[model samples]
Structure formats: structure tokens, C-alpha cells
Target: MKNKNVFNYLKQLHADNAEYKEQMAELKKLPHEYQVVYKEIQNFLWEFTSGDGMDMLQPMYGLLDFFKEGAGNQVPVLDLVGEDVGEFAETMLHEIQAKTRINELKRKMNERVKKEINQNK
Candidate 1:
């Protein structure tokens, strides 16, 4: 019974990891404009989940608003260009990977805790 639970948990973790990896790969292939927004979303989500010192949803939505404005021609192209854009892109990608690892660690820790609980029971 314990083996079954362990196996199921591992399987779910693997699936979740794979799905996130695929999503990241797809995001990487997007054009520069869309990619920036996608990366920001990933960053915000990761930071939010990992107890970062920021209002995740608000900043994320704000970024979305910026993207939307750009798309609608309300924001100029210069707004999303330059060295800052490159830096942001790099930082966002790094955060995504970091967050993925953190989530995996958390999942493993939870599994360990569950195993202990089950054994105690």
C-alpha cells in the first residue's frame, strides 16, 4: 500500500514537471514581444508561489496590461525595447527554472512527510 502511494505521487510529480517543461519550451519559441510577457507571467507565478516579497497577481496583471497596451498601440515599441528588456528576459527565464526546482523540492518534501505520516498511522 505504501509502495502504491509512493508510486502514484512520483508519477504525478513527473507529469507535472513534464508539463511545466513543455510550457517553458513553447514560451521560449514565442516572438520577442509575446515572450517577454510570458516570461514575466512565469516569473510572477514562480515568485508568488515561493514566498517572494511582491504582490504577484497585481504585478502580473499590470504586466499583462502593459502588454495589452502595446498590442493596442497605446504603448510605443520603445517601451519594450533596449538593454532593460534583455535583462528582464534573462531574469525571468532564470526565475522560471528556479521556481520549477523549488516546486519539485517542495513536492518531494511533501512526499517524505506523507510517507512518515503513513508509517506512523
Candidate 2:
């Protein structure tokens, strides 16, 4: 479906009961690492359903936050690939820093332009 992100893909799957079941069956054939994530999500859903509906979302949200922060790949890649991965991570950090600086500069420039326009008006 035309380059949808993971959330949209998941929404589509959830919308179709038959397709969702079919995908669940297919998930068993995935690699162990991938299967583990699926299992964890299923466990979360089970808990989310069985519990009082409050606090059950924390673990699921925590898992999403872990990935959002790139913590999942950081240590494992370093452990598996050693020093080279460290250099790659360092490069990534520098790139992120550069992007942040560039964005800040753009924001400041835009604000100055807006202020000047307002003063002229």
C-alpha cells in the first residue's frame, strides 16, 4: 500500500480480521529474533486485554520508546561488530549533531525574517 509507515501498515492489518490472522500465522515462519518481537507484542496485547486497561500500556510504550531512541541497535551492534561499529555510531552522532545545529540556524533565521517583516509592516 503505497509506502505507508509501520503504524499505518499495522492499522491496515488490524482492520482486516482475516488478513491479520493470516499474517499472524505467517509470523511463525519468521526468524527467531523477529518472532521474539511479535511474541512480546502478543503478550502485551494479552495483558492489555486482561488487566484493568490502565498501566498495561506502559510496557508497550516503553518498547516503542526504546526503538525510538535507537537503544536497541546501539549496544547489540557494538557487541557484535566491536570497534568498527563504534566508529559508525560516532559518525551517526556527529550527523545528528550537525542536523540539530542546522535546524536551529534555520529556525533563528526564519524568526529574524518574520520579526523584520513585522517591524516593516
Candidate 3:
């Protein structure tokens, strides 16, 4: 039963991956302006994954949403791309928030420790 479940999961995963690749190929077939945006996104991803910076997130997400809305429901490829960009931006925002909270906690802890040390002296 366990093996059957694992096989089913793997099959679904493979199917989903194939669908994603097909969608991307279709996106590549878009007209010049759309293709330009797609290429820019590709370049952005390469830079992003290569550790360029988080500053590009906002602008990229904006551009993605703009294109997606412009294409509307007629273009599933654009919608998917926009959704992906939004997800990425959300993830980055969460990470930044988490780091900020951690820093605040650390600062409070350090302040408390310093006060305790000063009192001892």
C-alpha cells in the first residue's frame, strides 16, 4: 500500500512537471513584446538565484502583474507567471519580516543582559 501511494505521488509530480514545461514552451512562443518580458523575467531569475539582491523583487513583481492583467484570462501563461512572481515576492517579504523580528528579539535580549551586568557591578 505504501509503495502504491508513493508511486501515485511520483506520477502526479511528473505529470505536473510536464504540464509546467509545456506551459513555459507556449509562453516562449508569445509575440515580441510578450517574449521580451519573458526574457527579462528569465534574466531576473538567473540574477536572483545567483544572489544578486532582493531590490529587484518589487519591480519585477510589478512588471509581472502588469503583463498578466494586460493579458487577462485569455493568457494562462501570463497568469501563471504573474502568480509565480507574486509568490516569490511574498516569500521574500516573509523572510525579511522574520529576520527583522529575530533582530528585535536579539536586541531586547542583549539590552536585558547588559542591564543585569550593570546592576551586578
Q: For this target, which candidate reaches the highest TM-score against the unseen true structure?
A: 1
Please provide TM-scores, in order, for all candidate models, with all chains considered together.
0.40, 0.26, 0.35
Q: Compared with the true structure, what per-residue lDDT tens digits does model 1 show for residues 1-121?
A: 9999999989976876685566556545445666665565555455435444222333444445556556566555346544466566555545444444456578899999999999999
Whose TM-score is higher: candidate 1's or candidate 2's? 1
Per-residue accuracy of model 2 over 74-120 as CA lDDT, tens digit each: 54423332446435434433433323334556778999999999999
Query: Residues 6-113, candidate 3, lDDT per residue (tens digit)?
Result: 999899768766855665566555555666655556464434342233344344445455555655545654454555754644554444343333455677899999
lDDT of every model, 2 decimals: 0.57, 0.47, 0.56
Which candidate would rank higher by TM-score, 2 or 3? 3
Ranking by TM-score: 1, 3, 2
Q: How many clashes show up in model 1?
A: 0
Clashing pairs in 3: none
Q: How accurate is candidate 1 locally (lDDT)?
A: 0.57
Model 2 spans with C-alpha error above 4 angstroms = 1-15, 50-121
Per-model C-alpha RMSD: 10.7, 13.6, 10.1
The candidate scoring highest on lDDT is 1
Q: Relative to the unseen true structure, what is the Cα RMSD of model 1?
A: 10.7
